[model samples]
Target: MIDNLIQGVFNGVSTGAVLLLAALGLAIVFGLMGVINMAHGELMMFGAYTTFVVQNIFKSLGEPWSDFYIFAALIAAFIFTAAIGFLLEKGVIRFLYGRPLETLLATWGVSLIMQQFVRSVNWVILAGLLVFSILYFGGVWALQRRPNWDAIKNWAIAVLLPLTLAIAGSMGVFMAQIYKIAVTKPWFGAQNVDVTAPKWLRGGLAIGTLQFPYVRLFIIVLTIACVIGIYLFLEKSPWGLRIRAVMQNRQMSACLGIPTKTVDALTFSIGSGLAGIAGCAVSFLGSVGPNTGQNYIVDTFMVVVVGGVGKLIGSIAAALAIGTTSYLVGSGTFTNIFAGIKPLVDFFTFFATTSMAKVLLFVLIVAFLQYKPAGMFPQKGRSVEL
Candidate 1:
C-alpha cells in the first residue's frame, strides 16, 4: 500500500512540473500588475504553435530538428509571446491598470482575437515568423537587461546548441566529479532524474515494485530546477531585487529611478520564457498542438490564485499541492462527495457532475481565498506601501 501511494506521487510530480511553469507566469503577471491576463494562455498557445512552426521550418529547409532548433524555438516563443505581452501592456493593459475586471474582459477579447487569428491561419506557417521575431529580437532584449552569466548562457544556448550541449556535458562532468552527493528520496517518492536519451529511445524504466518512467523523472527535475533558479534569482541578485520591486510596486520603483519600463518588459519576458520552457517540456509528453496552451490555462490560473497573487515560491507550492490532490482524487484512493459534482460544475451546471480534479481545484481555491485571502505567502508591506 505504501509503495503504491509512493508510486502515485511520482506520477503527480511530472504533471506538477508543467503546471509550475504556467502557474509561475500567471503568478507573476497577476501579482505585479494585479491584472488578470486572460490572454496569458494564448501566449502559451502562441509559444506551442511557434515551436511547431520552428520544427516544421527545419523540416522544410532540410535541416534536422536538432536541439539548436529547439533552443531557437524557446527564444522564439519567449519573444513572440512576450512582445505581445509588452504590446498589450502598453496598448491596453496599462490603460486598464487598477481595473481588474475591465482588464480581464479586455484581455479575454484580445485572447479571442489571437485565438481566432491563429485558428484562421495555418498556425504552422506562423510558427517560423514567431521564431524569427523571438530570436533576433529576443537576444537583443535579453542583452538590454545586462544579464548575468547564467542568463547569458541561457539565451546563448537557445540560438547555439553546441554551446548548450557543451554546458550540459560540462554539468554532467561536474556532477560526476563532485564528491558523493547524497540524493534523498522525497516523502512522496524516490529522487528525480533527468533523461539524457533522445525521445524515440528514452523512458520505459522500472524501479522496484513501481514503474519509474524516464519521462516522469525528467519532468520532476526540470520543474525543480526552474523553481530553484527563479528563487535564486529573486533572493540573491540585485536585478532580481529590482524585478521584484517592480512586481510589488511599479510606480514607486519607477519614481525611484529604476528603469521601470525595462524591468516590466524583462519581467514579462521571464514569465513568458517560463511558458516557453513549459511548452518544450510538454512536447516530451505528447504531440503538441497549436492550441496546447488552452488545456492548461484554467488549471494554471487555479494554481496561482490559490498560491497567492505575487509570490513565486507560493506558486510552486500551490502547483504541487493542487496537482497532487487532483491526482489522488483521480485515482479514487479517497473520494469527497463534492467530487461527483465536478462534471456538472464544469459545464456551469449547479447540480450536475463534472471532472473530479477540476471541481476539487475550484473548491480548494475558494477555500483558500476564504481563509487566507492574502495567500500562503503574500508580499510583505503590500498594504503598508499602497
Candidate 2:
C-alpha cells in the first residue's frame, strides 16, 4: 500500500510537470498584459502540429535522422507559434487588449477555423506522423527501463529538489512586465534535425523504484532551461525593467522611449512559444490529433486562475495542483460521477473519465474564483491588479 501510494505521488508529480508546461506561458501573458487570450490553446495546437510536420518530414525522407527530427520539431514549434502570436498581437490582439469579451469571441472564432483546417487534413498522414514520431512516450519507456542514468538521477535530485520548490511559488512572474531583450540571438545556426535517430537518445534513468524516460527527461531539462532563461530575462535585464514599466503604465513607458507595442508583440510571442513547446511535448504521449489542445485548454485556464493572474509563479503552482488533483481519484470513477449533465440524453450524462475530470475542474475553478478572484498571488500595484 505504501509503495503504491509513493508511486502515485511520483506519477502525480510527473503529470504536474506537464501541466506546468502548459500554464507557465499563460501566466506570463496575463501578468504582463491584461489580455485574456482565448486562443492560447490554439497556439499550443500549432506546436503539436509542428511535431506532426516533423514526423511527416521524416517519413517523406524515409526516416533519415529520426531522433534529430524531434529536435527540429521543437525548434519549428517555437518559431511557428511565435510568428503567429506576434501576428495575433499586431493583427487583432493589439486593438482588443482592453476588451476582454471581444478578444474572447474573436479568438474563439479563430480557434474554430483552425480546428476545421486540422480536420480537413489527410488522416493517414496524420496517424503516421503521430505514431512514428521520436517524442512518443512509448519509445521513451523502453529506454528508461535499461540500466543507466541512475547516477545522474542521484545528482539531479539535489539540484531538482530545490529547483522545483523555488519554481513552485516564484510568483514574481510580473518581472516580464519590466524585462527586455539585451542581446536578441538570431536563429541562424540552427541545423535542421534529420529524420533518422540514434537509439541512445531514446533511453531513461532509474531512481529507486522510479523509472524516468529520456523524452520526459529531455522535456524536464528543456522546460527548466526555458524557465530559467526567461526568468533571468525578466529579472536581470534593463529591457525587463522597460517591460515592467510598460505593463504598469503603457503611456509612461512610451513617453520614456520604450516601444510598448514591440514589447507587447514579443511578449505575446514568447508566451505563445511556451505553449507550442508544451504541445510538442504532449504529442509523443498520445495521438497528435487536431483536437489535442482542446482537452487541455480549459484545465490550463483553471490553473491560470487558481495560481493567480499575471503570476507565472502562481500559474506554475496551480498547474501542479490541478494536474495532481485531477489525476488522483483516477480518471475513471472521478470522471463518471463528476461529469456535467449534457443536454442530449446520450451526451455527457452517460459519463466519461477525461470529460468528467474536465467538468469537475471547471466547477472547482468557478468556486476558486468566488473565493479568490485575484488568484493565489495577484500582482501588487494600482495597475498590477488582477
Cα lDDT listed for each candidate: 0.68, 0.68
Encode model 2's per-residue lDDT on 194-285: one tens digit a residue: 22223654666777776666766666677677778778888899877777687677877788899888888888888888888888877765
lDDT (Cα, tens digit) per residue for candidate 1, span 227-292: 888889878998889988887677789899899767766676677777767766666666555356
Worst 10 residues of 2 by lDDT: 182-191
Cα miss at 379, model 2 (Å)? 1.1
- Evaluate residue 354 in candidate 1 and report its C-alpha lDDT on the 0 to 100 scale: 27
Residue 41 shift from truth in candidate 1, angstroms: 1.1
CA deviation > 4 Å runs, candidate 2: 59-64, 121-204, 331-352, 384-386
Q: Report the Cα lDDT for residue 355, model 2.
A: 60
RMSD, every candidate, angstroms: 15.3, 19.9
